[model samples]
Target chain A: MAYIKLDREKCKGCMLCISVCPKGQLKEDKGLNKKGIRPVRFLDKDCSGCAFCAIICPDCCIEVYK
Target chain B: MKKIFGRTRSLRGVDTHYCQGCGHGVVHRLIAEVIDELNIREITIGVTPVGCAVVAYDYWDFDCVESAHGRGLAVATAIKRLQPDKIVFTYQGDGDLAAIGTAETIHAANRGENLTVVFINNTVYGMTGGQMAPTTLIGQKTATSPLGRNEKTEGYPLRISELLAQLQGVYSVERSSTDSVQGILKTKNAIKAAFKNQMENKGFSLVEVLSACPTYWVLSPVESLDWIKNTMSKVFPPGRIK
Candidate 1:
């Protein structure tokens, strides 16, 4: 299992991470950040710690742990 | 649990000024990661350009100097020459490097300055409201060229990496993109290699990154990446030029 922490305040809700995550581990959260953007949340159970989300994220808001 | 991916210590924890889906933030993170990995943050001197990344010094926790419009290469050259041991790099955008700073960049590379240049080619003058840039593709539409860039008047997109590769003083040149996971990884490696070449005192090294300007392109974040892979890469393919 992999753990991903998102710095919601730092996120701009670009959604680029969603397209890159192989595990479908990230999705848009209903709540909005201070910037009025819907930040992403970790959602899947079968994460493989691929850091693709971190690499593709323009905001550097996601941190993955294994 | 061990941390697998986290923000590099070289980068400030604050949010960047870049717009959503802008590639500047990713490029900045990659450069910060490279600087941290090489343990050269203390000795590295970055020259920030006058385009969208004009305030790049605020994000990277290192010594940075702001250069005038299109003068980043000239400033970086002076810094590298004065302190030969210090690591010097320039962060420039398409409008800054491929347009106004063309002469400075070419001459510096031709002189073989032991420096690294991270050029962001987003195909438009992003900070100046999406004006057509020298790197703008012939058929791409911009604020200045609403009917698409006309070949007769705009000439052609400036292939800076290929152009710099032909110069004898340049030791390494690569064109990469930040549009996908694989492209981002390749871009990171290219930037690292550019820095390594400078560390080895191997003349001039440049990594031209095809970045996205979603705000100007008027595309969603995902569409911009798709355009980069499907459209942009056709005009400027990703690969090593030198």
Candidate 2:
């Protein structure tokens, strides 16, 4: 199974990752992060490990593992 | 579990001051990744320009020197000439390069300085508010060009990469964008190629990256990216110029 780790504190909630995620496993969290921005949450579904989200993240907040 | 992607050691383990979804951070990570992949962090020296990325040294772990606005190429030229063994590069913005520093950039490329240049063309000035830059699209509107850039007055967006590519001193020039995953990957490859060229002493190499300025463009980060892929690419088409 593939999974992605998010550095919540560093996330600026740009949502660029959400737009690129092929699996549609990411979504905006209802809660705000340390920066008071709505961080993205992974649904823990089947991940393809494409790393597209990580590649498109402007803040370098996501790390993908397969 | 195998780690497919992560931050590079060449980048400092600190948050950048750039706004959320800023392209500068993405480009910074790409440069750091390239530095790590080439194992040149120790020998590489970056010259920072006087624009939004002026404090780029804070994010890059390697040595960096600050240059006057539009003088990044001149400083890089000097560094590369003084220390031929070291890999030198300049990180400049559209305003710093195509506008205020046009002469320096042209001269450095003409002199065939063995160096790399990472030119970020966001079309507008981001740090000091959204002002029409030399590379701004003719019809694009900015603070200075509230009614859109008029060709009769502003002439046209300066195609610096194409202009530099025409010079015999320039070895390679590519215009890449960070609009999508594929585009970002291409941009990284272009940056790596530029760095590799400098390592091989191939004379001047430049990778002009079409970056996004969401705040100044009055669009969300994602929408700004689409704008780059759709509108901006029409004018500054991404491809190898030389």
Candidate 3:
């Protein structure tokens, strides 16, 4: 069940992490993050446990439970 | 349970020839891990440059070729274009990449050749008696710059990643460091991405790894890591440059 997360406060919601997910499991939640950018939302159920989502993330805002 | 030692038989245990606190070993291991994980041991061809990583052929157990200082990328480009079926990658140091091979690196990237560049930027030239490298930071002391690199005279350090990323032919370009555990892991992933992109026929890929040079930099291994973490990160930051 170990997968991924984007801390709401830390997530800049740049959409880069969502765009780079090889599995297309991440989505944008037009809702604002702490900085008011569209926060990156995750489809935890579809996560393949691949860390590409975490690696391409520029801000190091990704946390993979695995 | 974690696997012990290297995952690729391509890298036989010869006890690395690299000096302590040198990032070459870690970089080498990252390449090995990628080759093993991708199951491309026989297909991978590595081109070594004339620097600390020159003897990479001796350690990495794959098809290897040695090239002159700063000419590794040129050599790898030729090999890759001729043998596009093979996975071609060049392992180069800062002196080999930024200084002597500037034209080769820029043109190769501009051409979008299907090859991978594993650039180890240690700031100062390590093999050539610690000479001032193109990436040497201002106010940083080297053998050639006893009074530190005077930006007024020597000019500022060249940011290779930022420059290379601007080229249209490049498939991807990124920078990572080996100073910390997480950073080192990220460095491996970056190199893996470069190689993977090449395998997927994406075009030219370059992964600039900010490494520590204890012998050349005249700093203790621990101090060098600290310097890489605090000093180098300030200028390059981390993650994708492209």
Candidate 4:
């Protein structure tokens, strides 16, 4: 199974990853991090490992592995 | 199964100071990825600008020299001239490159300096609170231009890529955006090409990247990307200008 990890603290909660993920594998977290920003979370296990989120992320907060 | 994506060692283990959806962070990762792929971490040097990314040296894990506002090219020129073997590049913004450092940039390009320049064109002075920049589009409202930029007073958005391409000293000049997945990949390729051109001693090369400023643009992070794609791209089309 492919796995995508998001570094929550490093994320600026931009949601750019959510918009770019073709599989819709990521979603915004309801709770805020220490920075008081709503970080994103991996939504499902059906990840394509496309690395699109990693690429488009402005904060370098996502990691995709297979 | 193989690892597809992760952080590059060329970048430090620290969060960037850029705002959410800021293009500097994305570009920083691309540069770090390129440095890792090229195996030039040991011999690469980056010159920092005085804008939003002024502290870029702190994020990048390579030797970085801080340059005065708009003097990135000048500093990179000196560094490259002295350490002819090192891969020298400059990370600059529109305000630093197109405004304050225009003379230095033009002269460095004309001199055929062997170095790479990653110019982030967000169309406004981001760090200084969204003041109008040399690349700000017409009718674009900025901190200084509250009613939007007037052609009669502000003239037109400066097309640095096209102007630099006309220089005989420049070997490569490309304009790319970071609005979409395809655009980001293209931008990475363009950045890699710029660095590769410098490595081959192919004279001056620059990649003008049309990035987003969501906070200053008064738009959401996602909306900024759309602006880059639909609005920004029209004024500054993405492609190999040279």
Q: How many residue pairs clash in each candidate?
A: 0, 0, 0, 0
Flag regions of model 3 displaced more than 4 Å: A1-66, B1-7
| Model 4 lDDT tens row, B159-198 | 9989999999999999999999999999999999998998
Question: What would the per-residue lDDT of candidate 2 be over residues B1-242, giving only the tens digit for each residue?
Answer: 99989998998878888887889999999999999999999999999999899999999999999999999999998888899999999999999999999999999999998999999999999888989998889888899999999999988999999999989999999999999999999999999999999898888999999998899999999999999999999999999999
**lDDT to native, each model:** 0.92, 0.93, 0.80, 0.92
Scanning candidate 2 chain B in windows of ten residues, the lowest lDDT window is B12-21
**lDDT of candidate 3 over B69-125, digit per residue (tens):** 788888998898799899999999989999999999999999999999999999988
TM-score of chain B only, all predictions? 0.99, 0.98, 0.96, 0.99
Model 3 lDDT per residue over A1-66, tens place = 556766666555445456457788888786786565666788777766666555434334566765
Better candidate by DockQ, 2 or 4? 2
Docking class of 1: high
lDDT of 1 by residue, A1-66 (tens): 787888988889999999898889899999998999899988858889999998899989989899
TM-score of every candidate's chain A: 0.92, 0.95, 0.82, 0.93
Best by DockQ: 1
The CA lDDT at B46 in model 2 is: 98
Estimated TM-score per prediction? 0.98, 0.98, 0.77, 0.98
**DockQ of each candidate relative to the true complex:** 0.92, 0.90, 0.02, 0.86
CA-based DockQ, model 2: 0.90
